[model samples]
Structure formats: structure tokens, C-alpha cells
Target: MPVPGFADRWRIEPVGAMRVPGVVFASAALLPQVAEEEALRQVANVATLPGIVEASFAMPDVHWGYGFPIGGVAATDVEDGGIVSPGGVGFDISCGVRLLAAPVTLGEVGAALRRLMDRLGVTIPRGLGSGGVWHLPDAGALRKVLEGGARAAAQAGLGTEADLRRCEDGGVLVGADAAQVGERALARGLHQVGSLGSGNHFLEVQVVEKVDDPTTAAAFGLSASQVCVMIHCGSRGLGHQICSDHVRLMRDAMARYAITVPDAQLACVPVRSPEGRSYLAAMAAAANYGRANRQALTVTTRAAFAEALGTSAGSLQLVYDVSHNLAKLEHHDIGGSERLLCVHRKGATRALPPGHPDLPDDLRPFGQPVLVPGSMGTASYVLTGVVPGEAFASACHGAGRTMSRHAALRHVRGAELCRRLEASGIAVRASSLRGLAEEAPEAYKDIYEVVATCERAGLARRVARLRPIGVVKG
Candidate 1:
């Protein structure tokens, strides 16, 4: 089948057992880099999944991942023998970004920037092991986090109701069943709530450098020179254990149902099957854990600011909290009829358009805020969904990795990279120099190009640009 380009996207016609076609959103400039990896083939493999609707799609930042490409998006008709794959959601579960806009501006916080970052670095628990802002006293306390997410944390005095109102699914993914979570997963999660895991996760202090759409930016509580905190993390060990367990379960159960897939990593079962329901329930619980983890970090961050700059926690208002991973059951129009579908978005952000009922009342007219974090030391962007959106209203999550950690370590030393970042006036705090080397800015694609492709493809629109002034690396 011939691959053809249309506007900012390319179409790959289905062949063999593919149930649908494949669509990749990218500019000609990005095609070369994207083609350099195995992501395109993965996109084609994803099309062969049972009950897939429309076309398997890849965002501009698409890159090689375990099963589906990291930037992949696909929806399966739930009523039509649709299957849910753990690979589609990745191991992070609800690994996503949260943006908090502070009332202070860069000018007001300039003098104390170093002190504030130092305070945050110490207060924020990070790295591989296990430690967090809030330690659950027992399994019972942990259940509250798994079941209630950030909302439960708010009830425990970690945050406010207003914060939950700004979160996706109100900070708790409905239908989560704590009982579905395994003992090992529970133990791993107990002490890890609110920790920033190693490898690409971070807590950044940024300043709004520019506003592309003044009205929408204002609606999102963002303005030029305003300070913000961007957190990129997930459910930590709990989510990973769940994915590992479910993937193994599904792989073993597929044979009984006589279902075959192109890749074993794409292990799946019918959405209505026993194993399938179990995974979804456990996944939701982990997602809630992820949200609560971020909320705990928010509390610590606010307290750090108060101690450093005398600003109250209330000064930091959540602009939005959205997840980029997980398979969600949502109602969408297909063939002119509303259908329940399992939408899987791995390393991709959901960009719901304006007027969507799911949006908060205050943000309904502006659309959902899509937080796109850039590679360390690079500029991040805030984008909004547009009408007639494609790929189920999804957009790129980050500047996709271009080089592996080993390759990046061979290319640049962590000490040199830290020096360069500090020289540019960006403060650096990392658990280890080697960890910093793995995330050198050169390890990823150009974030500006990726965001431009998303806008050009009409997946989302730019609202504001954020420049990192300080970062806490795990």
C-alpha cells in the first residue's frame, strides 16, 4: 500500500489482517526522524488489533516503545468484541502532567529564586527507592489514596476542593477498585505516593515567556512573566507492577479465547472478559494513586514557596491536570452513532474541544488545557483543543526521545550539561549526575517542531510558552 501525505498527516492503507488504516500526524521535516525508529511499523501493527475503529494514529512525537508507539492513539469498539491492551496504556498508568500557576511573577520571585528551588529540592522526595511527602500508616490508609486519588488527599488536608475541580476526572478516575490491586503492588505504592521517579520525571519551576492566545491563556490563569510549576510523574512502582501482572495475565488468557495478535507485547482480552475488567479496575486504582501523588507534591511545593517567599499555598492555583496514559471508556460518535469505545492514549495528551461537557464550567468556552512539557532546559507549551479534532482529540505529550540514555551518556557529561544549564540562568537539582546526563536536551527531538506539527495538524492550538528557570530531577 502506498503512503500519501495530506496536510500535516500521512496515511498508510491497511493490508493483511489490519482492521483499519493508519494515520501519522507529522510534518515533512519530522518524517525523517520519525522514520528512523520502529514506531511506524508499530503503528501498522496496532491497526491489526480486533474491533479497532477509524484508524490507528500516531502523533508528531511518535517513537519506538514496548508495543504501541509512545505517541500512539487507538480506540476499540467496546460492544464489538473490543480488546484492551496494557501496552496501549504503557506501565505508567496515568502518567501525566500537571501545571500550577502561582500568583507571583518572575520579577517578584527573582531575588528568592535560588532559595525557593533549594527548598523544593530538599522537600520533594525523588529517585528510585521509596519515600514521599505523605506516608500511609497502613494498607487502610493506602486504600484511600488508591480509591480517592487527589480528592482523598484533599480531604486529608493535602489540598483543596478547588484543586480537585481543576483536575481531570476531578482527580479520581471513577470505577477504581482497590481490591483489584495486588498485595505486591500495594506494598510498592504505600511509601511511594508523591515521589518523582527516575528517568524523565521532574518538577520544574518555570516562567511564562509568552502568550500566543491571550484570551485562552487568561482563562487558564496564565499570563506573561507569571510563575508556574510543572510536574511530570506517574503512579510509580504500583502502576508498573499492575501492568506487569495484567500483561502476563492477558498473555496467558488470550489462547483460551482463541485470539491472536501480531505481537506478544500487545497482549489483550475482550473488554468485557474477567481478566480485562480486572485490569481496568486495577489500572484505575493506580491512576488515582498517580493523581494523589502529584497532589502531595503540590502541598510540599506550596509549603516550600511559603517558607521561601512568604506566599500562601492558595497563591498556586491549578491550571489543569490531565493524564496522557491509560485506556478510557468514553462515548464518541462513530459512523454517525454514539458508541462506547476503549480509547488508549500512551504518551499522548487528551485534547477535548470547547463545549465538551467533560470540561469544567469556567473552562468550557476555552477547551481543555493540554500541557506539553519539553526536554529539560527547553521551553514548554500550553495548548488547547480545537473543534473538528483528529485522533480522538489527542496531541503529543513531550519532545519524543531521539536518543537512548546510553547514547546520551556517551555524547555528553552530566557535569557539563549542568554547567551549561546553570550558565543559562536555569537552576539544576538532580539526585545524581548520571541521571542528568541521560536526559540531556540533545537526547530528544525539537519541542518547538513537535508542537508546531500538532498545531498544523489541528490536533491542538498553542496558548502559552513556558521557560524553565529551575528544575528538580529524579
Candidate 2:
């Protein structure tokens, strides 16, 4: 039986071949919901993985997901038999959120809100099979995007260097290997840039509602009632294919490597193994694809906002672009010794603390921006990363789903929900009513409570709260 209530976080002692303890971060109110779900079991299952160093950790928004919990985080020493799993990263590689602040106030765009949503809905391709928004000129151009990510997009005049610097890894993984990208994946992702893929993905126009830390908010170029655009997407079909292809390889070759897991979905190979090296290179490429995809969408969004509001494109300044599903080689101090490890965050976001070398010069005094999106038509929070004391510098990705998509459909109708949103002063545009119904806000945990728990857990501190004025779902 699970422990009663959440106490900062609960600890699961190693049992049945477990390599480490399982730790869950939640509040008393959230513990019962978490305990009733299968995510806790998944958390424990992760503890049995190869060379796991720290505890297998889950954030407050944890829910049952593929192999690992939705908000799972783990690190294994690369020099000590660490391995990388496609399951640990998820199918939508580098799925992340980008926040861009518009110089205009919400009051300024109040009357034009409906028109703006209409324009964005028409101009931005979304839903399944959505593509051709990035204008890839040739196969060579596709390779460049897969390799350089948003940096390449900026070079092509989509954004500026300032925007690139504000992004994680400068919006590019410099080590991406295009050669490792499979042809099928290439074909699938060639033109999908600037598209919002289906299921929980969205493009929203928001207004900053409240600021918890005015100093940090100002640094992020945010003010109360300021308009902003938030984009949630990933590498699309290409990342999915890469994960599928690599998972098959690792699963089949596990016996040869003398590796076995409680679950086949946790398939992995050593970080330095030929297969692992190949996956890393390929994963980096897919992640780059995700970065490039979001960057392209940023370009489209800027144009759409500018055209609708009669403001210059430069008025919409990028706040941050951060990836979630990724396994990166990083250095973390473990037991008085700094060691290099492969950190896997499946449905989590990096919350780099202040003074971290990875942060840009301007943001160094503060910390990394952590965008935690809520359910559709709900409130989202912008947080500043703290020291990342015990959670491996990670935080919850979103208001994790409490009910499944099927469950959501039974609870609400998409058309009715849209009407309610509009009545509540929010605009809704979606390609699929079914998709919209599946993403109903009631299907997920209360974001305000989740964020409150995260703040209490010392993972990150809230900076600003944003409420959606208009939303476009895929």
C-alpha cells in the first residue's frame, strides 16, 4: 500500500531488484489521486533500470505514461554503465514550450481578439498530417533544419540571434548528426515545421494575469495584462519514427548486450555503446527538428500577430524556448563528487538554477524560465528555476492528465466546451472537435494546486501567471 498523503515527497525503498529508491513529489491533497493511478508503480519500475544513480523521481503532476511516469526524471552515470532509453525520452522527442511576449497590452488587442484567432487558425496548419508551414526548399534544407534547429531558422531570417541566445542550447544541438536520421523519418518530418501536432498540443494567445516575483517578471519582459503567445509542439512524425526505430533496435539487441528489464518499453543500450551513440546522435537530430519546428511556428505567429495588430514583428520578443523530453549528458554533483551522467527527463523540464553556466548572460542573475502549461482554457504559470536541490534540476512539465482522453469525451462535448470558453472571454479554434473535447480542462489536475505544490517542494518558484485569451488546438 502507498503511504498516506504526500510529505514534500514520499520515498520508496528498493525492493525486488531495484537499483535505487523511487521518490514522488506531491502534496497531501494530490497523494490520493497519485496513489490511485498506475504512475506510482511505473515510478518504482524505473528504479530497476541499469546504472541508475539518484532516486527515480516524479514531479507533482505525475501520471501513468509509457514505461515512465509523465513527470519522471532520472540520471545514470555514463562512466558507470549508464544507458539511454527511447522510452525514457518519449516518442515526441524534445516536445517543449516556447513563450513570446507581445509589446501590446491585452486592452489594446481586446476588440481584435476574435479576428486574431481567426487569422491564426487559418494561417497555422494543425492537427494530424499538418505540414508545409516551414517552406523547406530542398532536401539539403531539411538536413540543415534537422542539424542546426532554430539557429538555422534564424540564419534563414525566421528569428534573430537574441532569440537564439534566449533558447536552451541556443535553440540548436550543435552535435546533431543528420546522417543518423532515417530516411523514413526524414520523409515524415521534411515539411512539418511550424505545425502544431495533435493531442494536447496547442498555440495560445495569452495575457499575463499576475506576477509573483515582479523583479523576475520584468527581466522576462513581462507585465500584468501583457499579451503573449505560447506554443507547445515537438519534432512531430520524425521524432516519433526515430524513437520507434531505435526502440526496436535496442529491444531486439538487449539479449546480445545481456540486458533485460521488467518492461520491454524500457528498452535501452549503454550510453557509450555503438547503438547508444547512434541513438544519441539520432535523438539530438530529432530534438533539433523539434527546436526548428517551434522556431518556425514562432515566425508564423509573429507574422500573424503583426498583421492582425498592426505591430512590428520585433514587438513580439521571445521569452524562452525549452525542451522537455530529452536525455542529455550533464554534470551533476553526486555525494561530494561531480560526475558526468546521462539525465533522462521524459515529461519534465530543466530548471537550471541561477549562476548556471548554460544560462544566457542577461538571465544569469535570475534563473532559467520554466513554462508550465495548464489544461485547455486554464491558467499557466511561468516559474524561475531554483537550485534544483534534490530533483536533478527538473520540474513538472504541465498539469498532468487525471483522466484519459476517452474519459474526457464522456464528461464534456467539444462544441459546448468551446461555447463556455467563449462566454468566459476566451476564443477557441480547433481543427477537430473530438480533439478539443479530449483536451478539456477538467480532464487534468488543477494547475494552480499543482504549481503550488511544486513551489512548496522547492523545485521552482512562481514568477508569473498567464491566462489564455485565445487558443488554437491541433
Instruction: Give the C-alpha lDDT of model 2.
Output: 0.89
lDDT of 1 at 313: 33
Candidate 1 clashing pairs, residues 3+ apart or interchain: none
The most accurate candidate by TM-score is 1
Best by lDDT: 1
In order, candidate lDDTs are 0.93, 0.89
Clashes of each: 0, 0
TM-score of candidate 2 relative to the true fold = 0.98
Which 10-residue window of candidate 1 scores lowest in summed lDDT? 1-10
Candidate 2 lDDT, 39-146, residue by residue in tens: 988998889888899799999999999888889998989999888999999999999999999988999897988878988999888987767488887778899998
Error of 1 at 299 (Å): 0.4
Q: For model 1, how does the per-residue alpha-carbon lDDT over 1-474 read when each residue is reduced to its tens digit?
A: 324444778888889988899999888888888888899999999999988999999999999998899999999999999999999999999999999998899998977999999999998999867499898899999998999999999999999989999999999999899999999999889899889998999999999999999999999999999999999999999999999999999999999878898888899998989999999999999999999999999988888989999966336999999999989999899999999999999999999999999999999999999999999999999999999767888999999999999999999999999999999999999998999999999999999999999998889999999999999998
